[model samples]
Target: MTMEIPIIEIKGVGPETAKDLEGLQIATVEDLFEHFPYRYENYEVRDLSTVKHDEKITVEGKVHSEPSLTFFNRKKSRLTVRVFIDRYLITAVIFNRSYLKKQLQIGETVTITGKWDQHRASIAVAEIKKGKEKRSRVIEPVYAVKGNVGVKQLRKIMSAAFAQYATQIVDALPEQLRTQYKLMDRVDALKAIHFPLDFRQVKQARRRLVYEELLLFQLRMQAFKMLQRREGKGSPIPVKKEDAASFISKLPFPLTQAQQRVMNEILSDLKKPYHMNRLLQGDVGSGKTVVAAIALFAVAKAGFQGALMVPTEILAEQHEVSLKALLEHEQVKVALLTSTVKGKRRRELTESLKNGEIDVLVGTHALIQDDVAFHNLGLVITDEQHRFGVVQRRTLSAKGNNPDVLHMTATPIPRTLAISAFGDMDVSTIDELPAGRKEIRTFWAKHDMLERVLTFVDAELQKGRQAYVICPLIEESDQLDVQNAIDVHGQLQHYFQKYNVGLMHGRLSPQEKEEVMVGFKENHTQILVSTTVVEVGVNVPNATVMVIYDAERFGLSQLHQLRGRVGRGSDQSYCVLIADAKSEVSQERMRIMTETGDGFKLSEHDLKLRGPGDFFGKKQSGLPEFKMADVVHDYRTLSVARDDAAALMHAEAFWKDDSYTALRHYLEQNGVFNKERLD
Candidate 1:
């Protein structure tokens, strides 16, 4: 097929220009075809007298005089022209468009769309095209330009690609669906999207392309689930209600209705024959861990091994302690393994795991190591799933034979993100807090209020409650003048001479971090100064105060997670943010944090504040990137596509049918056929 042909085939595109195309990710004909425009320019002529200053409007006119060009500011050039619109000769100023001077003659008609400069009685040219047709105004595609690749160059390349490879653009959506959806042809849509004849064509092209992209993605997700089902049914773990009742009875407090509901959903998945893929999401300290504990207990009660993988060693240790305490009476053997386990200890732990001596094994990425094996693994649970990518999650899942997977995240993801990122998995949320849990008293103070904050921390410490002092940076940086953990640790230690303040940061060894966290858990350390490394599942119920320096520098989600470090116990908790926020966004974030303790709401605010690209902050969440579909705004289309894909897959023998052959081939070509990375 010509789809994989290189980009050097264009008429004037030499080696250098072809290399520049790589900056736009256009190396192959397929890449060039998929390099969709970010926006379009509508050159429909409008009345000049109606629009106000600075409003973008299109005008039809003829050149009144020969255009003039002038050079300025390094290599910049400008072209000035007088266009006669109806009876009025209006001046048009175009920047860096020297080529326009040659084509514009004294009487040639032109269409100009730009911002109106009322005082100057002219239009600042945003786009100028040679056209006079009133009914068929050109809707020009605007590709994102970078490096040396300009709009003209990209347009030429796209035109050449369509001329040569239009026949190769196979319609992944079958004829049946195309007719049913009243969509445009695949080739027609591709051409009209780049060079549309009218507004109706652009609308049709966009709808066809958007639906195709979204449908293909949804098909991949559902196909993956179908393939997993065909592989084999998982070992069904029967729920023992009596044992669960006894376990709950031994707990110090009652489970919230939310937790009970999630537990019931998980238990339903466990007893099913097929492998269950579920996502458990909730606000931090909302009793997610206890609910996961109950599910882990059910897995062990079925006499099959379960592995619970977390992102950090401290979280692993914390889970280990909590699980052992909760499962002790039930005779469920729980074990911990991490990078710190080595030599004789490592060998013995792996051996015990292989022999099925451990009912639940908790650890960090170490659980996915090749040496770690299971005798009869049935259930796999991963905590803080965003910190681990699909590779790690699937690697751990591969250790078991068709194990039921439960992905837990304390950092609540917004519905837009959750639906798109985890659309394939069944989602269960623990929205309500447990009984006796108090709302964390949140306060935002300027840097000058540190003395009062310190006094409050001193009072909390005097009551034998520990505190956490969070700094944004681990080391002093010349770029940012924010507080570092080392400096804050020293200052706190000096201020509270009687209290033992331990230091922790990312640079410390895993064993050292474990030691510091253990000391804090044991009440030996009254305060721990650290970076965002403790932003995940570190449960120290004794810690009642979290003081974050330069809190405005952090995202609202991060601040919420840091606040979650406190308020784990029954006693009232507090979070102090010391920042003199100058930006409106930062000040708004502070206000939001002080106003509510809902992580999901804070995450939605964070999404709006930072947008989709910065929301995850370099973490992999297994979200598929779409060419034309915007998950934030096109969620309705996403839902429809999901339903269509599901309904199509649910049909009998759909994969083997000829009408669905193109879709199956697309799934294979798009890298969705890989089973290991499907999760």
Candidate 2:
């Protein structure tokens, strides 16, 4: 395993530099190769005629004036000169480079790249081409450099690594598949990705490398799924549909088609002798909770306890209240556990849970504590499951003897991500809303129009409907220019003095948060001004109006989640997004929020905007940190590679076949999967 050779073996990377590289998670030769550039900068000359103001461009021109150097602030100096390129004349200034004046003589041709200042007809020169080199600058790979390590230094180290150890990089894709897919050899792609000769080579190499990464990932996932299926060690909980039916009969309304479909899918999995690994994806207000409730009730009736873990204490309490109301009559005892549940109550609750007296336990990460135990645990359900990492989920599930695990997310995930990130699990989508639920009318307004927006909220409040005014910050900050909950609450209270306006933020104690939530839920507060803490699972049907101040500060998915707080009941709901959106990206986010209420569409846009790592905290989704593959932009490649991987995984001799020898060896030696991950 030469790939295991220490990075310090590379020339120019001494012990100090090696320690710095290790800060970036690069300790071995293989690690250095895998540390691909995040982006590439092309210094090729551009057409000056089409260049915009403040845009980076490179152009060659004659030196129309002698360069004059001026010293400033003792150490800083500016070298200014005028150059004419084609038909346009512009001034170029290079800061702190007084020595460049000798090279920038009049009547001499010069080339420079910098941001174009159209109004001033000048360029803030980033780099000045020296000597008579006529061709455009080389396209350079840009690595993510932290402390001590510079980009140029990293690039040098990478080139050295490639020079010495690239031959050790084996081609995992068989020749037949590579030929069919028109992919480059693994060694060539890795070399090109690190030191691409041109933009075209970068693209081609990226295509090949992205495919390899995604294929390996999918193979790992499919293999895990196959192994789990073969094991079949899960508790064979009886599918007590009759008990679920009786509970549903007592409910105020029947399950929607999507809910029934997903519920049946989950229950059917429970009936199997093998453990169920499934993802339940639904829109913000698509009734996913009801489906979860039904599953839990069935599990409880089967003489086994269920555990529901959420991200926040407020959400845990809310789930406990709702689940209790839904299952208490059926003699199913539901309890809440969080950091707030302490001392005597905590001990009593845990003891009841161990004794099998509590049929269902709902809580935050507290459910994963070593002290927490479940008697005959049959099912584990996590609400808004994306907020918890894989380790947390596994630890909670480990408390039981191979219990069925159901992960749910209110944020609708795109199909591409579902196939890659959660590829190991079966997927169940709830795309339909309840029959009587109304579409939430969304609006975008400038911050200056707050008076008019308040008037609308006032009208809604007058009609006996409550409202929510959300801000980006809990308190004022010296850095960010955004609305804060405390100030907004004060302003709203002053304006709507006739009604109570409640305020909530993270700094508040758990009891205070509970009191505020209870006040708002009971309609004791007409308007609730809060921060993003209310995004997860605060359900208030009577509140029909949602006004988000500084809405542009939020992502599309987040805005959609906040809007889901309303629109729960039959009454028409309205969401007003008030912001001083300056950037086009922010404006576009606001426009999309007003355009449609589809969480899937918004989530797709969100994925494209924020990427999968940020969209679902990377560790929580267990998505690998891919260097070349982008789940959003490269979805087509992802799909093709996914299918190819599935076929190869299902092949008769994938593990032992000679054709797949290189592939299996590459993956195993590369350490793609671990015991904890597979389990």
Candidate 3:
């Protein structure tokens, strides 16, 4: 016999309410049990005298006066209420709640709870009840609400679900492991997460749950990696040490020790029978592209065609130019394919690719289109790997016979995140920058600094050098008060009319964008005022100044990428960040740019400050969205989990034991085991 839980046994959840729950991805008792609270509300009771005007608190006071109502707008039917707590008066305003006037009688005592607004200098009551018998706790669980699902209602449903599922909750981790990690039982942790008696209990329970989630995820990743190593089919493409040395010797500058180390690792992986599914991560201007080009050349020399896929047409074009120049001395044919390539030219390129006439092909998503086919494609390279989804990468990989994949990214991801997000692939890092590159001078300035910045740009332009002016938005929107690129372009044109000004944005056509980019590159336009469309490409060697407007609106990595546009040339460059907002996080993010040029250090700081989900847009990557596990605070746990997963997978006991059965089930349910189904 099974004990019936109220939420599970009760059959009267209406379709409308069910749809609201579905929006949160909660449809059953199990889903409700796992729907953790985003934050906790600690309502500490305080006396009226001790109550701060703006601080949130719960107080019990006698109502000394009758509630008074005032009408603000008859058109919108807005009303405000004034109530006195003892002798001190405080206002409780509600929108479109004029009907509440009937409930508050003269000199009636009531208990109210909500956030205290400093602007109004009153407590904004979110919930109110009559009589003095109401009991308020010190700690309150604030859950994400659905339609008709208030905190109290959500608590009741969760309580019922926990009662039923507590016994059914299987421990994913072994008893010894849990004890060693100082973690609570899975069932107890879930219960405490939903209904914690105190803040300490909540914190402890959250830590355990976060550890478990990460541990299971790490286990699955380790298992998948092992399976891939065992079963993956790959052919070794051999290259002599002298051949690699000759290629590196021909480069304009000497390779950094870090770059040489990464190349050697890739060379070893290529020599192995198993295909290489490796991620090459480095800071902007860390010489990732050069390393990738070397690997492509090696593969090409091995008599296998290689393809480089980028996210945008401009990046595709840029890669083609860079790779062609790098491999020009070598006997290899490289071709570019983009959406812009039309009719006869497209047909010719496709025919050449299919016939193995082209040694290397570089293009955007056009490479994966149904009409596009490859001949003897043995290696694949994707720049800015995070921009492409898992399905998109798989689609490109499927173009060839499961070719060896080498994904590259300029955005330096934190170690914890790298393991969680790209756990299925081996990682290589280029930790050092190339020689002779000067660190770009970065500064954060207020609006008052604009004139000085413009004067500086004018001085640079006078010397025949170019500059880039980046705006956050393309067009004006009534919703946001941000400065648009078009408005900035007009202002710049008026201010710097003597110099040519060019504009580019996502709204502009490909032809118009190409024209402006070409002008900027050729110095026809000394100042290119544009949006982030130029963030990925549009490299101008003569440009030495980059002024980013509203720098606070950009992520740390993105801001780093924008700054990378200028410092590419040999001459000294300056990046001026103009921000009006004075948020602490924003200030810290900007400070990272000024303080250090290391992309990995900045990324670690970003993860610590912004958390994982916010660092990577929730919908952008298929990596699991963490609710509580912070990569910064949980780094130790992440390391332990990674080690534990690896050790367990290597143990012969894992295959025979039923202890990991629940973990395996969880992985399968999350689709981590099935690589083919990721798309």
* Candidate 3 global lDDT: 0.80
Clash count in backbone of candidate 3: 0
lDDT of each: 0.85, 0.85, 0.80
Tens digits of per-residue lDDT for model 3, 1-679: 1122323353445666666667777766666777888887765555567666666666545554455566667734433456666666777655556666788775777766777775665777766666663444567688888676678867776676665567776677777788887889877888788777787888889888888877877887887877676666666777565777889899988999999999999988887876789999988789998998898888888888899999877778888999999986798789999999989999999999999989899998888888889888888999988778878888988887667899998888888788888888888999999887899999888878899989999999888889999999998889887779999999999999899989999988877888889888888889999998887775688999999999989888778888888988888999999987689988888888889888788888877777777777666646676666766688888888888888877877665567766665666666655633111
Considering only N, C-alpha and C atoms within 3 Å, which residue pairs clash in candidate 2? none
User: Candidates' TM-scores?
Assistant: 0.83, 0.81, 0.80
Candidate 2 per-residue C-alpha lDDT over 1-679 given as tens digits, one digit per residue, 9 for 90 to 100: 2278898999898989999999999999988888888887767777788888888887888889878888988879998898888888888988998878876677776678888999999999987875443643367888888989999889778878778877777677888888998988888888788877788888889888888888887877777776776574887899787877787788898788888889889989999888999999999778888888999999988898999999877778778888988888888899999987899999999999999999999999999998999988999998877778879999998899889999998888888889888888999999887776789999999988999999999999999999988999988999998889988888888899999999988899867988898899999998999988888757788999999998887888889989999998879999999988899889889988989889999999988887888776655666777767788888988888878877877777776668787777655655554432223
Runs of candidate 2 exceeding 4 Å displacement: 11-26, 38-163, 224-232, 236-257, 293-376, 386-400, 419-421, 617-623, 666-679
Candidate 1 lDDT over residue span 7-91, tens digit each: 8976677899999999888898888888888877766677888779888888999999988899897569999999999877789
Off by over 4 Å in 1: 5-23, 48-53, 60-113, 117-137, 146-149, 163-168, 179-182, 198-201, 240-254, 335-358, 363-375, 386-400, 448-452, 619-622, 671-679
Q: What are the C-alpha RMSDs, in order, of all predicted structures? A: 4.8, 4.9, 5.9
State the TM-score for model 3. 0.80
For model 1 the local lDDT of residue 258 reads 91
How many backbone collisions does model 2 have?
A: 0
Predictions ranked by TM-score, top down?
1, 2, 3
